[model samples]
Target: MNTTYRKVIDRITAQTLALTEKNREKLSACLERFEWAKNDLLLREGQVCKYIWFVDQGMIRLFYNKRGKDLTEHFAYEGGIFLSLESFFRQIPSRLIIEALEPTVVYGLGYEKLHGLMETEPEIEHFYCKILENCLILSQQKADACRFETAGERYHRLLQEHPEVVKRAPLIHIASHLGMSPETLSRVRAGLL
Candidate 1:
């Protein structure tokens, strides 16, 4: 396996339940590397998300269109995973669009292959379940932040927690993710400074 793929596997093994070497080899075989340029769309609205993508480099944004405006829902950077979880699990069309914000390298596991691995290896199944749980927790946290936190508070929390986002992502995208206008985010940043 290449270094990028190795890095992705290492990250997965570290984050999820420990996997035996045999299982790790099997899982690594299922990963396929892909490269995307900035502005490339991995999954568009209404399309089924076919792969669970592990970012070995660069960044991705998950967004949706509403009233002709693109609203960012989440971001995945190096060492992160990006996928339409509901669409991938349920085999339904996704309402979100996933796009690369920078030249990106990813290792993807096809949905069918993932299911096969889960069925054949108990450890893989456990790992998959843990990933699902984490995804759920993240979703809930985002929802809570939107509901209870002020825009400035949300921006500050994001800076503290995901500083890569503020550093790497465009200001406009950061504003959208924080549920604030560009001007508002600028004011918040000014206040912080």
Candidate 2:
């Protein structure tokens, strides 16, 4: 592999390791690197998601269409993981759309290959468990934000969590993710001033 490719995979292994060099070699060998540009579709609805991606650089968004409108569900940035977890794990068609929000470099492992690695490498399994735990925690936070927070509060939380998105993404995109209209988001911003 090229040096650039090795560096990116090394970064992913670092994150996957959770600061521990447990099974970096096993995980590293199975990884593949790919680059994508802003607005490019990484995974589409109805496609069987093949790989679980690790974002080495830039950002990605996961969304699904609702009444012909794209509803943003999740955002993964540098040092974050990106995958259609349900589809990849179940080996079913994906219901969500995954796209790069900026020019991105990613390291991915095919679902089957990842499963094989986990089974063969106990330390890899530990890293996988940690990644899943992060996923679950974030899912729970999103659910709680939707249920209990006001629209403005939820928007605030999103900004707090991903401040770069406010500058990088279009206002409409942020509005949709927050389940609010652009006008409402403007008003909310004004109210804070």
Top-lDDT structure, candidate number: 1
Each candidate structure's TM-score, on Cα atoms with residue i matched to residue i, is 0.95, 0.89
Model 1 TM-score, all chains together: 0.95
Residue lDDT tens for model 2, 1-193: 3555556657765655542343555566678888998889999999998987888888899999999999888888877887787898788999999999899988887888878877867777777777777777887888788789888898788778889888787788788888788888898888752
Instruction: Indicate which candidate wins on TM-score.
Output: 1
Tens-digit lDDT track of model 1 for 1-193: 5655656777977876788888787888889989999999989999998888888889999999999989999999987877898999898999999999999988898899989998878889988888788888888999999999998899999999999999999999999998888999999989952
What are the RMSD figures for all models against the true structure? 1.6, 2.3
Q: How does model 2 score by TM-score?
A: 0.89
How does residue 156 of candidate 1 score in lDDT? 90
- Candidate 1 wrongly placed segments (more than 4 Å): 1-4
